[model samples]
Target: MDIAIVGGGAAGFMAAITARRTNPSCKVTIFERAQKVLAKVEVTGGGRCNLTNSFAAISDLKQAYPRGYKLMKRLMMTFNHEDAYRWFEEHGVPLVTQDDDCVFPKAQDSHAVIDCLVQQAADLGVMVCCKSRLMDIRSMQDGRLELIFDNGTQRIFHRAIITTGGSPKGNNLQYLARLGHKIVPPIPSLFTFSIRDKAFCNLMGTVVDPVVMTIPGTKFRSKGALLVTHWGMSGPATLKLSSHAARMLAEQDYKSPIAISWTGERSRQEVEENILAMQIANPRKQLATLHPFGLPSRLWVYILSKLGLEAAKPWAEIGRKTFNRMIETLVNDQYTIMGKSAFREEFVTCGGVSLESINSKTLESKVCPNLFFAGEVLDIDAITGGFNLQAAWTTGFIAGSCVAE
Candidate 1:
């Protein structure tokens, strides 16, 4: 069988290698638009290339994917994180899991991971064509898939797999959709919110731990570390909420009000009681100098100012109304998200090809026989920490294995 894999990204490369491994006599070709393959993998995780996550069960892993959790649950059961780790280990690329369960190459370099894929494909006689852009694709009268390249090159294959990622520059989706497949509109995921707050200026390095961030009008909430930026807030918590609320935020034109709780572990009543105890412990101390409840001193001052409380006033002199206001700000700090900043290292989309169109068992298109889908191209995206890449590996392996047979 002659197999044509579009997009020389993580998914495409994995699919090519798997196809060749499953059927050594079959010819597998990977066409990449860019001069370099795995561009995102080279820069992902700050050059570490978080390959997979440590989540064991399909149920636990599906929680990270908001768009295609149900589909991913079924796909992961076939080839999940453990299988991915073992595949890498067999190929001489051992992986290590970090404290947060993010798995990376033991060499601590993305090039190591990319090199493994490149070498594996080469060893399996997979043709990796770089800078070969797929301009169009059509199903011939004989039921073969023909691909037209930008450089006036054409090739026909028995089967084709599209794993071109979620970039607007690529023609993978357009060409595949022209062949008659539903294309779900893609949106930016795993991004940070842009806020118009001056308090965040010159405080770009300030990070608050264990903060709860939520998007109003949506049932999205995340608790993790948050960073204050010149434009607004960022970090794990903000990015996770942004991903889960990507569609909602886009519908609002990225101008949505977000609520943040600095004390993620404490309730409003608990915060108020803690403040009362601090006030009793240091009645004569000024609010600015007291810095109660373990929050950042600058943030405490800002919260007091927002609550209309004088920072120089002693703790004993503050009225119950002001105390309540401060409690409210600490427990429910609100910020208007004016825009979004792409986490350029690993920006993923939450939606793509509808799951209903693909068979979960083999990742083969239910609408088209011998045509498969995988990776971010298939309406499946997960939060950070290598979950998205794991999905790609899983679906790509399944598609390649089933197609090769």
Candidate 2:
């Protein structure tokens, strides 16, 4: 049997290797568009290559995967994070889990991962054809699949797996769309919001943890450490919130109002009580001197300045109206999301080939036999951390395992 894997990425490599392993007599090949393969993997997670997540904090898969939770839940039965962790370690890459539950190679370099995949494929005799962009895919009458490359080369394969990852625009997936698969319009996910407020941007270096951010008139919300960037906010909370609200934010033209609770998951009443206790505990202390809720001093001062409150005033001098206003600001600080900026080198999109058109068990296209999909190309995406890569490994494993069947 001959198998072709298109787009040499995390999923493509994994699929190629798994296919060869599942049916050792089969010949497998990877066709990559770029001059080299695994380009994104080289720079992902700032070059450390976050392989998978421990998922210790995730009781529900939806918490990590904003989209495709149901499909992922089904796929996890065959290959989950634990399986990925074991696979990497058994393959000679030592792994470590950070405090945030993100797993990376102990070597602390993406090359460690790159080397592993390349070596594994080489050992498995998987043919890697770089600079081989697929322009079209057609089902052959003989039950084979024909892959037409940009270079005018055509190849017939018994099975094909599309692991092309996410494309920023719809046209990139046109070939797959021609095959009758439902294509979800691709939109950016896991990005940073661009805030136009110059004053807020001035707090670029400020980082607040355990803060809750919510989009108004929407059910999207995220809680984590938020770093104020020069242009806007970029951090776990912002990235997660962006993932959850990717479609809505895109519809709004990236212009939406966001509500943030400086006090984290604390209720408004709790914020009030905490403020009251702070005032009582430090009656004579200046408001500016004592920051509440373990908030950074600069952020607290910025909040006070925004409220037009005298920073030099003693805590005891706080009036009922001012206290209420303070409580409101602490729990409901508002900001407009003017635009979006890419989160470093990572470009993740939530939209792709909708899962409705694929078999959940094998990740094979329901419309086209012997054609399967894995990774970001399948309308599946997750927030920051290692969830995205986990999706890649699991889906790739499943597709390769069942592609020949």
TM-score of each: 0.95, 0.98
**Runs of candidate 1 exceeding 4 Å displacement:** 56-62, 169-172
lDDT tens digits by residue: candidate 2, 1-405: 999999899999989899999999999999999999999999999999988999999999999898899999999998999999999999999999999999999999999999999999999899999999999999999989999999999999998999999999899999889999999999999899999988888999899998999998878999999999999999899999999999999999999999999999998888898899999999999999999989999899999999998889999999999999999999999999999998866779989999999998889899999999999999999988989999999999999999855
Ten-residue region with minimum lDDT total, candidate 2: 342-351
* Candidate maximizing lDDT: 2
- Measured with C-alpha atoms, the lDDT of residue 114 in candidate 1 is 95
Cα lDDT tens digits for candidate 1, 2-73 = 999988989998899999989999999999999989998999899999999888433464458888888777
